[model samples]
Target chain A: MLSVTPQHFLILSFLLVGIGFLGLLIRRNVLLMLMSLELMLNGINVALLTFSRVGSNLDGGIFVFFIMTVAAAEVAVGLALLVALYKKRNSVLSDDMGLLKN
Target chain B: MNAVDLLFWLFAVLSVGGGLSMVFSRHPVSAAMFMIVSLVGVAALFVLLESFFLAILQVLVYAGAVMVLFLFIIMLLDVGPEAGKGKLSHFKTGIFGLLATVLLVGILLTLGNSYDSLALDQSIWPELSESKDGASHSLPFSTKVSSFGYGLMTKYMLPIQVSGFMLLAAMVGVIILSKKTPDREDLK
Candidate 1:
């Protein structure tokens, strides 16, 4: 019987973070980019939970709770802004977000 | 070594596969689906961690609530990865993406040793004392929702208040962002 190590969580989380960074780099769409941001947040949640187990306290779990709360609020406000931007400019891509570059 | 470890591995595999697919899948609907799997896997991991409260919250708030908003936005937009295809510079992105992968692999190997050391130093098995072993004794943590309410009102009162404030601020910001301007012709 093998116990899963904290290292497993760490490896997977960093991998997700790397992929999220790449997604943010490669994608031009604001919506996809927001989803990528959520990916990164989930990665952090994994790290926090791993540490919580390792530390013998409920702090990391609480931190993850706070992070989840923030992530929800962010997505709500963020999607609204994305919709507004699209309604104004007819695009979700980042290049079109530079409406103030005049 | 324990039931918790077994559940952890199952959910870990589910999470990684779903997360990777979420990132790479071209279709927005597919990506959203992958995310749902990943979120569920994370919730299971929380259960394995004995944070019954967080587990149910994750499922209810993230999987149930957030995913609904995601689907709504996608449908309202009426444009997914299919509609978004054939427009970006794929070749340039592919090259840069390759470079990033190489860098990421290298960095992970160097930094990952720290994690391995921590795992080696700490005991992996759960420490089940008498309180934990008593099948007849009620578990300290009740159902997810109840324990969460207890936790929030007891040990977590301050943070919960802070989160409420943050939610209020975010709502105001959303209103400001989406509100149509006063001028009738300002939309252009």
Candidate 2:
């Protein structure tokens, strides 16, 4: 309990991902869902860093850098889509955007 | 009981607690704030791992730029706490939550079972070797910014270029998505 190991970091990563997944499952607001997505990505980042440290591999760090780049791009595109959706529907709830459900 | 252990636990609690609060928070703005807290905590963990460069990048990109973008959107949309209250049935949400919980538990259990195999030999850290021309120069991995730069500019060059292109595409896409389409009257 006192000593920190790779396992502890891995567990933390899993917990973060789990919480994010729970949020994604339950949340209806698109923005909240996006936030949860970020949380999940962060969790993955933790795992990657841990592996990088344990193996002394720089590839993991490189992967993380790319992940961050991709994440930023995703958020930009996602939020823009969200704005367009709001403009059209006047609501950000996923339930309201189901125009094809009928 | 050691400083590393204490710091790990402190930041772990901070990050996990921030995540929980972000998920459960009633307001989108507050949720974003909590996410910033969580990102900062994760940055601290990066520092603990001795990846100072990545830690700073996490703070600058995630906690700084990405979060500001989130807040800007929140304000632009004028979203309120009411936006969070969905009309979805509780039964469906409950079922989904249960399924998610089950999946999480399964993954954690698998991880726990494989925990022994994941143990690291602290003494043996890989020292990457780069062979140029005839000479093979060995580079021991250290959490240094210079090393990251070297790797990015050399081995990971293609991926970085691809990432740059993707970012440009995203920028163009966002502009197009958010642009006001000229109505028939405006066209006339």
Candidate 3:
């Protein structure tokens, strides 16, 4: 009989983080990068919930709740920025936006 | 393996596979869809962990609101697949892949031996049988939703209010940034 433990959850979280990180590095599209960022946050949220379960601490859960709020706000702001960038340049590629480049 | 373990494996595979697909997908819309799949799987995992409130919130906020925002932006911009720079230069992609693999291996090695030692601190975690408010309780299990509400109203009140403010600020910021105006100074 196989039993899932906190370690199993931890491993899963780590794998998710790795995938998100790799995607962030390899993807050039700003939208895909934002999605990867969300994936990474979701991974961290899983870890927080696992810890909350193991510790029997509602604090971890509360923390994740706050994280969700922050993540929502982040995505809102990020998408707004992406929209602004697209309007300015008519392209969403990170390479195409060299506005910061001197 | 019992039904729970089987379900765990299923959702775990769904999440990881969806994430991988999101990464490899050529089109932004496909990547957005894959992200939804992954987010739903994470919500399922949250359910299995018995954090029903968090699970519901995960589905509501992430799968519902966030994904909708993502799709909205994707549609609004009409962004296409990343202009073919070979998806990524082979050398850089290989380097990132290698780094991620090394990071995963390091984490596994560290957790392999010490995972057991990472047990919950008994003092901080009250048992289900423990009494609250100097009265004995007969609840067989913790009521997470009530407890969560209590904690938010009491201990975490400040941060909760602050988060609300932050969300409001972001909302205003997004409206200002995205809306077109005749005299929009920031756009110029």
Candidate 4:
């Protein structure tokens, strides 16, 4: 039985982050992109918790809580923006959002 | 070989697999489901780290509340499976994939190699007492709910209040933005 080291958690989390990054790149759907953002945040949460455990301190967990709070706020604002975009363009594709480029 | 290790591996696999499927699924609803699974898996990992309070919070906030919000938006939008045909060029995708893979491998190698020396010299606090029996491992610090509550109410009170205010502001903003105003047409 091998011990579950912090290194293992770090690598797994980095893998998750990479997967989320790839999803962000490949997915044109706005909703899926938001989900990818959540994935990336979750990966960062895992890393924070792992470091907290390794250091035997609670600060990391506290930071994770703050991150969750910020993530929630972000989701709220982002969904509102998405709804506005949908109302205006009748589409949720990133390509349809070029109006902001000018 | 041990129960802790076994559970860790299982939850790790579950988390990674769920995340991958969530990203790759074309349907938004199914992708949201996978996201829930991955969130739950991460919560389980939090529990294994002796952060029971955080584990429960993770489940309550992320898996429960946030995901429900996501599902509601997804259902409200009613967008069907995103049509990915002929959107981006294959060369662009290949470039993104290659870049992600290289970044992942580089991070894995660097972190894996340097991890031991990075924090090995520091004295880790709340050091768990080694127990031959797997079930006897106890948290070295008093991480009871009361202590966490005290800390939240005392030392971290300002941030908590700020977060509450932020949440309230977000709620009001969402309501205003999503409201069905008659002038919406004229504004557009």
Give the range of the ten consecutive residues with the poorest summed lDDT in model 1 chain B.
B134-143
Off by over 4 Å in 1: B1-6, B82-87, B120-158, B182-187
lDDT of 3 by residue, B145-181 (tens): 8877777787777898998888889989989887888
Candidate 1: interface RMSD equals 4.0
Clash number for every model? Answer: 0, 0, 0, 1
Q: CA lDDT of B101 in candidate 2?
A: 86
lDDT string, candidate 2, B89-176, tens digits: 7899899989988988998898989877766555223344443332223233467698788888877778999999999999999998
Share of true Cα-Cα contacts across chains kept by each model: 0.43, 0.66, 0.70, 0.58
Write candidate 2's Cα lDDT for A19-89 as tens digits. 99999988888999999999999999999988887776667887889999999999999999999888778
- The candidate that achieves the highest lDDT relative to the unseen native structure: 2
Q: Which runs of model 2 end up more than 4 angstroms from their true locations?
A: B83-85, B120-140, B184-188
Estimate, for each residue in A27-51, the C-alpha lDDT of model 4 and write its tens digit.
Answer: 8898889989989998998898887
The most accurate candidate by DockQ is: 2
Candidate that would win on TM-score: 2
Interface RMSD list for the candidates: 4.0, 2.4, 3.8, 3.4
CA lDDT scores, all candidates in order: 0.76, 0.87, 0.83, 0.82
- Lowest-scoring 10 consecutive residues by lDDT in candidate 4 chain A? A52-61
**Can you tell me the CAPRI class of model 1?**
acceptable
Worst ten in a row by lDDT for model 2 chain B: B131-140
lDDT of 4 by residue, B5-119 (tens): 7998999999999999998898999999999999899899888877898889989998898899889988998989976565778898789889888888998888877977534
Candidate 2 or 1, higher lDDT? 2
